[model samples]
Target: MSQTETNRRLITELQSRGLRLLDESAGAPSRRGGAGPSDHKAVQINGQTVMVPVHSRSAAVSPFEAGASGANGAVQLTRDGAHVGDIRFPEAPRFYGLQTLDGVPYWKIAQLHGTDVLATTVLQTCVRYGRRDTSCQFCAIGESLAAGRTINRKLPEHLAEVARAAVRMDGVRHMVMTTGTPNFTDRGAALLCESAFAVRAAVDIPIQAQCEPPDDPVWFDRLKAAGVDSLGMHLEAVTPEVRARIMPGKAEADVEQYMAAFADAVAVFGRGQVSTYILAGLGDSASAILETSERLIALGVYPFVVPFVPVGGTPLAEHPPPDAAFMRSILQPLGRMLAEAGLRARDIKAGCGRCGACSSLSTYED
Candidate 1:
């Protein structure tokens, strides 16, 4: 197979089946702190960075596993003991070991996503998490806070300190700051604006700020003025029924509100700079996802369609991940749609879509 085809196939497999570590002593840098599926490990295969679930039940029985024996810091990827390819585990970032003046670990404030983009949830507490009927079934935003792996709320000053360290020590090119919705009309936009300002003041890096649509559309301009290069308003499920079933409270910000918000955000951040995350497996059919992608693309919103990984400790922990075939069916056409519309991830200034590590859509953006 061609290298590109091989990579596409491998990414589909890894994201769907996860990866098993045959040797725990292989010295791979496992995830130590973060929200949602804290057991993932970053691995590079065929020049693409992917987060593979290593501690999930599916991974324990996954056909794919990494063998310890290798050269040049590379390991062998195998399926049922048959060689597939060579994979390399990324080393932990230097910033992970550093601490703030108050003695808080830098890693607890922000963690590396994909290869070099630093990511953090600014507000760990969510208004919806208090009630099972309202919480997003796939969310584990509070898991890290509960485990004491991260602070409940990251102060702007501390975030600035960490951003400076991460950029200086690890060559982090960009940053993604997402926040759990607080019980404010601004829906965490105000805090994101403050945090974005601090990070930009400390480093020259581009940043993406994610939150639900605020009560006021003017916050989009405020975020842009605060040095936020991109904006993300995630609609994890495209259909209202699926959304209501999967993320009850979040679904209250109906499709119409999100559409309005996306329009407002795009006006400030510009077309490709605004994006939304669409998780493809919570019972949204490929047709529904594609139709929604069309609408988002029309509004200049880059649809970052990703496979649903059942996060541990969440209500959906036992829910199976989308099948590899199912994901490819969605991504292949969705990638083509993005390419034709000139809404490629590379065109995104900075954000999850631009990072494009969690999904294999970028590979199919031919």
Candidate 2:
């Protein structure tokens, strides 16, 4: 097959496989059944168990290195024309072996993203984490809590110590800090600013923070002034119907509110420096996602679209991912728009938009 034909085929299979994976993970009380304890990160996809990353803040263990068996899983992967492993295991972060003066665990506060980026949720609990009906169905922020893997809130000192350790010890090149929604008026953005400033006091690594829009748009300036280099405000699913069903509590805040937030954020962060995650496979139409992408690009915002990776214990684990054809259909065209808008990912200072490795949108953008 020609190169284009090969990529097209690969994209299709990835979507189908991702969708099939989600379906098997949902409906069960947990993604793993009859599998006993199972190391907390083993998940089954259509009876074929696979090891997936489990986020934690207190311990320094590679959930990937401890993954359960999946010899039956597919392994043919296409990356830069080389067929490689379907999912390579992420190495343990180099900083995991350290701790703070108070004996606080370094690995417990921050974890590695991809290979070089250190990422963490500044606060582990969300106002909605306690409410099932209003919860963002796919989120597992509370899962680690039940497992005793993190504290309810991460102190600024904890973030600072861990941030410095990740960069100094692990050679981390970038950092990202996010937080759960607070009942407070600023939607958790201000807390992110606080965390960023704390980290900035010790290190010079580029940092990105994600949060919902604040009632006061000026907090965007505060976040930037505090040394946050980029921003992410995820619009997980675009259409109102899917959002209402998938992220009920967050959906209560409408797209217009998010758009206004993005607009103000772009003014401070500038062009590609601001981003929003548009997750695929939550049952939104491909056209709707592309429509949202076009709108975001017009506003000079990078719409970083990623295929939804269902958490094993989440409510929608059984929901299938959108097929590969669906992903490319939206991404290829949208990638063109990103190029036309001169909103390239390379321009983003930090976070997922710059990483572009998690989603195949970067593939299409190529």
Every model's TM-score: 0.97, 0.80
Best candidate (score: TM-score): 1
What C-alpha lDDT does candidate 1 achieve relative to the native structure? 0.86
Reference-based TM-score, model 2: 0.80
Writing each residue's lDDT as its tens digit, candidate 1 over 1-366 gives: 897887898888798888889775554356633443256778898778877878767888899999884768889999988998898877778999999888999888988887888999999989999798999888888777888888988999999999998889889999999999996599999999999999899889999999999999999999999999999999999888999999999998899889988998888889889998898789999999999899999999999988887777789889888889999999999989999989998888787888887888888897
- 1-366 per-residue lDDT for model 2 (tens digits): 776545444543443342112222221122221111111233322222223323221112211122222464433333334533343233466677787788767766776655567778787778886677988887878766567655567788788888888888768888888888886588888789888999999889899998887779999999999999999888899999999999888998899888888888889988888899887889888889888888888888899887665555678655555656677777788878888788887778898777664565655555
Q: Summing lDDT over every window of 10 consecutive residues in candidate 2, give the lowest-scoring window.
A: 30-39
What is the lDDT, from 0 to 100, of the residue 241 in candidate 2? 94
Residue pairs in collision within model 1 = none
Per-residue error (Å), model 2, residue 96: 0.8
